[model samples]
Target: MAEFDLIERYFTFEYDFTQASNGSANNKSSQKNKKPKVVKGIGDDCAIFEIPEKYQLVTSTDTLVDGVHFFSDLEPELIAHKALAANVSDLAAMGAKPLAFTLSISLPEVNQDWLKSFSEGLKNASKLFKVPLVGGDTTQGPLNINITAYGSVKKGRLLERNNAEVGDDIWVTGYLGEAAAALELYDKALVQKAALNHSEAELWKALTQPIPPLKFARKLTKLSRCGLDISDGLTADLGHILSKSQCGAKVCVESLPVSEALVNFVGLEQARQYALNGGDDYQLCFTASSKHRNKILNLAERCQINVTRIGKVQDEGLQLNLNGQPFESNRVSWQHFNQ
Candidate 1:
C-alpha cells in the first residue's frame, strides 16, 4: 500500500483539527470536555500543538529495531504495544500527563494482517494510556518502530534524577526482572505455548506486556523529585540517579522486588541477579525523603500500585547488602552500542 493510503486506512482519527485549532467546538460542553491541545495535526507537513499556558511539555522518542529489540517472529500487535509503551514510560518517569504521540514505523513489507494487528495494538494502547495518536510516518524498509510521546506537567512539578538527597529512601514501583527472564527463557524455547508451565506462561505474558506506572508516577510528583524508569535494571538505573544527584546508595539485596514467577523459574539467587542487572522492566525507580515513607505507602495503596523500598541514598557510593552483610556483584545491565 502507498504510505498515505496506509495511514488513512489504519491510523485515521476522529480529531477535527480545524475545530480544535480555532477553539470553536460546536458547543461549550464539547469544548470543555475535550479541549484539544493540537492546533494542526496529521495531513500537514508539520504537526502544530498549543501547549497549555501554564504547563510545560515533556516528550521522548524510543525506537525498537527488528532483531535487537524483539524477535522478528513475534506478533506485530505486541511489537506495536511495546514500542509505544516504552516512550510513554519515559514520560511517566518525569511525572507528566500523556498528551499525544506520533508513530514512525519502517516495515519490511506491507502485510495486511500485520498492519491490521499493529494498528489495533497502537489504538488499544493509546486509549489505555489516555494518550492520543496525532501523526507519524510509515515507510518501506527494515522493520523498525519509533514512537515519540508528548506529555504535560504543571509548572515546578517535573521530577528529576538529580534531586535525590543523601538521606532519601529509594523505592521501585511494581515488580522487576520478569521481562528479562521472559526474554532469556523465550530465546531458549523454554516458554513454548504447547508445553508451558504456570510460571513460564506468566513470564511469557510479562515479555509481551509492559505497563508503565503513569498515574502512580503522577501521584509521586508531589512526593519525590529524584526518579527514573527502570529500563536498564535496578542497580544500573539507580546509578544514574545517584550519579546525577552526586551521591551514593545502599541497596539491600533481599529487598529487591522479584515476582513469584521469576523466583519459581530461576530460584532466589538467579532471580536477584536478574533483578539487579536485567532490563526492560519499565518500573519507576525513585528517591524521596524518609519522612515521606508513610505518605508514599499510602499513596501507593490508594493508586493500587505496588511500591517497594529496596534501598536508601547515601553520601558516597553504591553499596549492596545481603542478610545485613556486605555484598557485591559482577553483573551489569543491558548496554546499547557497547560493541
Candidate 2:
C-alpha cells in the first residue's frame, strides 16, 4: 500500500493542526484563564507535567517495527494493543501503577482506516490502565511505533530482579505454553476446529492480546524476593533473574503450567518445549522466600490469576532440571542472529 493509504487505513484521527497550533492564542485571549493544571498533553511542544513527591517515577519504552516484530497482515488494533501492553508489562515488573505514556510514530503516510483501528486499540488499552497520552512525535518513515510508558511507585516498594536469595521459591503467573501453542497454531494453521479440550479463540486472543500483570504487582511486592516480567522466553528471562540475583534455578518441566488449549492442540511434549522456550508471554516470574509460598498462593487466589510453583533458587550458577535431568545451554532466548 502507498504511504498515505497505509496511514489512513491504520491510524485515522481528525487532528486539526490549526486548532492544535493555536492553543496559545486561545489561552492568551481568555479573560478568566486559570493556569493549566499540567502542560500540553496532545497539543504542545512536549508533554509538560510535574510529578508529586513521595512517588518514584518508573519509565519504560519499547518499539515495534512492521517486518521485525510483527507481521503487516495482523490487525492494526491488535498491533497497537500489543505495543502498549508490552511496555506496560515492564512497569508491572517494577510494581508500579501506570500513569501515562508518550508515543513516537513513524509511518509511510496516512491511512485513515488503519489509523482509526489502531487509535481505538490504543484508547482501549489506555482506558484499561487509566494511562493517558501525555505527548509524542510523528514522522515519515516505514511503519514503526514507539511508546514510552510512565508509572509511579508507592514510597519505597519496587520489585527488583537483583534481590533473590538462595532458598527463594520461584513462581510464575498463569500457564506457560499457551502462547507458544498459539504461535505454533498460527504458523501451522492448526487452530482447533472443534472446542475439543480448549477454546481456540482464547489461544488466538492470547497470541494477539497479551495481558500485562500490573494489577498483581502490589500483592507481589509484599511477597516477592525478586521479580521480572517474562518476555525473552522462560529460560532466557529467568537467566536474567538468576544472573542478577547471583543464583541458579532448577525448573521442573512437569511443574510448569500448560493450558488445555495447548494440550489439545500441540499435545504434551511440543507444548512443554513451547512453554520452556516461548518468548512474548508477558507473565511474571518471581522468586520469594519459602516462608511466603502459602501467602503467595492466597494472594494469587485473591487476584484470580494463576500462580504456578515452577522452580527454586539454588546457590550456584544457571542450570535447568527438565524431566529430572540436567539441561544446559550457553544460548538462551530468541536472538536476532538466529532469525
Candidate 3:
C-alpha cells in the first residue's frame, strides 16, 4: 500500500492524533490542553507530567532484536507495530490505559523508506491506543527497537497475577493458534494455509499484523481477579500466573478457541497443542469470578470480541485435564538463555 493509504487505512482509524503532528495550529492546541504537565522536550521527546489526584503512571519497556523477535526481511512498518504492540500488551496486562511512548531504534544503515514505514506503524499503534509518541533515540547498530510505554490506572486499580483465587474462572480474549499457524507457514515443508479463512490476503495480514487488545484492559481489571497476556503460549504464561497466585489450574483442552485457519493448517490434535503451547499470540488470559460471567459476557459482546472460558483455577497444582485425566502445564518456551 502507498504511505498515504497505509496511514488512512490502518493508522488513522486507530490513532486519534495522526493529524495532530501535521503542522496544523488547531491540532497543536488541541494536544496542549489534554495534558498540561507534559513538559516539551526536543528530538522525539515525550513531555513528563504529573497527575495530581486521579491516577499513577505505570511504565514498561520491551526490546526486539533482529533474527530473534522478528525476521530481517519483514516490513519495517510491521516491525514497528509489533514492537509497540508488545509493550502495549504489557500495559494491558496491568489494566492500564496507554498515554504515550518513546522509541529507540538502532540500524545498520539509514534507509528512508524503512524509517517512514516504521514511523507510520508506530504512530498508528500509538494513536489507536490513545498514546502519543513523546521522545526517542536513533543510532547505527544491528536493527533493534526498544519502546517504553507509559500508561495510568485509577489509584491502586492495576491488576496483578498474584491475586488469582482458587475457584476463579479462566478466560482468554480472542482465539488462539493464529500466530503459531503463521509461524508454521515460514517452513516450506509445512505449507500451512493463510492466517484468515478464505483469503490469502487476510492470512498475510495476520502474519504481518497482530492487534494488541488495549480496549479490554480496564474492563478486565474490573471483571477479573488477575490476568496476563498470552505471549509465551497459554500453558507457559498461565503457569506464571498460577505459580505467582500460589494456585493450580485445569485448562480444558476441549474448550480452547482455535481459528478455522489453524484447523485447516494443522489437524485438530496439533492445533490444540499450538493453542496451548505456541508463543507470541499477544492475547489476554485472565481469571474472573464465576459471578462475573454475565458482566464479562456483556463486555465481550459490547467490544465485539471473543472470550473463551477455557478452564478454572484449582487448589491442588498446575495440571491441565481433558476427559477424565490430568496433564502438564509446565511446557518450556524459547528461553533467552537455554542451557
Candidate 4:
C-alpha cells in the first residue's frame, strides 16, 4: 500500500480537534474532567497543542530497530506495543500524563497482515493511556519504529534526576530483571527449556509488553523529589541519578525485588545479577525523604503498585551491601554503544 493510504487506513482515528483545541467538549462530563487540547493533528504538517496554563510539556522519543531492539521474527503487534511503550515509559519517569504521540515506521515491504496487527496493538495502547496518535511518517527501509510521545505536568512538579538528596530513601516500583532474564533465555536458546514451567513465557510477556508505572510515577511526583524509569537496569540507571545528583547510594541486595519467575528460571544469585544489570524492565526507581515513608507506602497501597525501599542516598559512590557486608559484582546494565 502507498504511504498516505496506509496511514489513513491504519493510523488515522476520529478526533474532534476543533472542540479539543478550544478546550470545549459537548459532553458535560468531559468538560468537567480536564483534558489537554489538541489544536491540530494528523492532517497538519505539524501537530499543534495548547498546553493548559500552569502545565509544562514533557516529550520523549524512542526508536526500535529490528534485530537490535527485538527479534526480527517477533509478532508485529508486540513490536508496535513495545515501540510505543518504551517512549511512554520515559513520560512515566517524568511523572507526566501522556497526551499524544507520533509514529514513524520504515518497512521493507507492505504486509497487510502485519500492518493490521501492528495498528491494532498501537491503537490498544493509545486507548489504554488515553493518548491520541497525532502524526508521523512511513518510509521504505529496514524495519524501524520510532515514537515521540508528549505529556504534561504542572509547572514545578516535574521530577528530575539531579534532585536526589543525601540521606534520601531510594525506591523501585514492581519487579525487575524478568525482561533481561527473558533475553538471556532467548539468547541461549533455553527458552523452550525454561518455558517447560511457563517461567520463560511470563518473562517473554514482560519483555514484549512492559507496563509503565504511569499512575505510580504521577503519584510519586507529589511524594518524591527525584526519580527515573529503570530501563537500563538498577545499577546503571540508579547510577545516573547519583551521578546527576552528585551523591552515592548504598543498596541492600536482599531488598531487591526479584520476581519468582526469574528466580525459578535462573536461581536467586543469577537473578540478582539480572535484576542489577538486566535492562528493559521499565519500572520506576526514585528517591524521597525518609519523612515521606508512610505517605509513599499509602500512595503505593492506593495505586495498587508494589513500591520497595532498596537503598539510601549517600555522599560518595554506589555500593551494594548484603546483610551489612559489601556485595561484589562487575555486571553493568545494558548500554547501546558499549554493548
In terms of TM-score, the best-performing candidate is 4
Which residue pairs collide, candidate 1? none
- lDDT scores of the candidates, listed in order: 0.85, 0.75, 0.73, 0.86
Each prediction's TM-score versus the true structure: 0.92, 0.83, 0.83, 0.92
What range of 10 consecutive residues in model 4 has the weakest lDDT sum?
188-197
Predicted candidate 1 versus true structure: per-residue lDDT over 207-227, tens digit per residue: 777889999898899998879
Would you list the clashing residue pairs of candidate 4? Answer: none
Model 3: how far residue 217 lies from native, Å: 1.6
Superposed on all Cα atoms, model 1 deviates from the true structure by an RMSD in Å of: 3.2
- List where candidate 3 sits over 4 angstroms from the true fold: 1-46, 187-204, 327-331
Could you give candidate 4's per-residue lDDT for residues 1-339 as a string of tens digits? 788999999999777666544335576655555556677889989998877566889899988878889876777778888888898899999999888899998889999998999999898888777788999999999988899999998878888999999999999999989998887656543334443457777888899899898988887888886988999889999999999999999999989999889999899998888888888999999999999999999999998988899999999799999889999875788888888
Residue-level lDDT of model 3, residues 1-339, one tens digit each, is 443343334333232333323233368554443431333432332455544355678899988988778886776778877888888888888888877777677778766687777778777766667677666666678988888888777766787899889899999888776676676555432244343346333334555577767787777777775888888788878989988998998888888988776777677677788788777888899898999999998998888888899999999566677665765443355457661
Model 2 bad stretches (over 4 Å): 1-40, 187-198, 327-332
- Error (Å) of candidate 1 at residue 108 is 1.9
Query: Per-residue lDDT for 48-122 in model 2, tens only?
Result: 554445457889999888876776667788888888889898988888877678888987867777777888998
Judging by lDDT, tell me the better candidate of 2 and 4.
4
Q: How many angstroms is residue 158 displaced in model 4 relative to the true structure, after the best TM-score fit?
A: 0.6
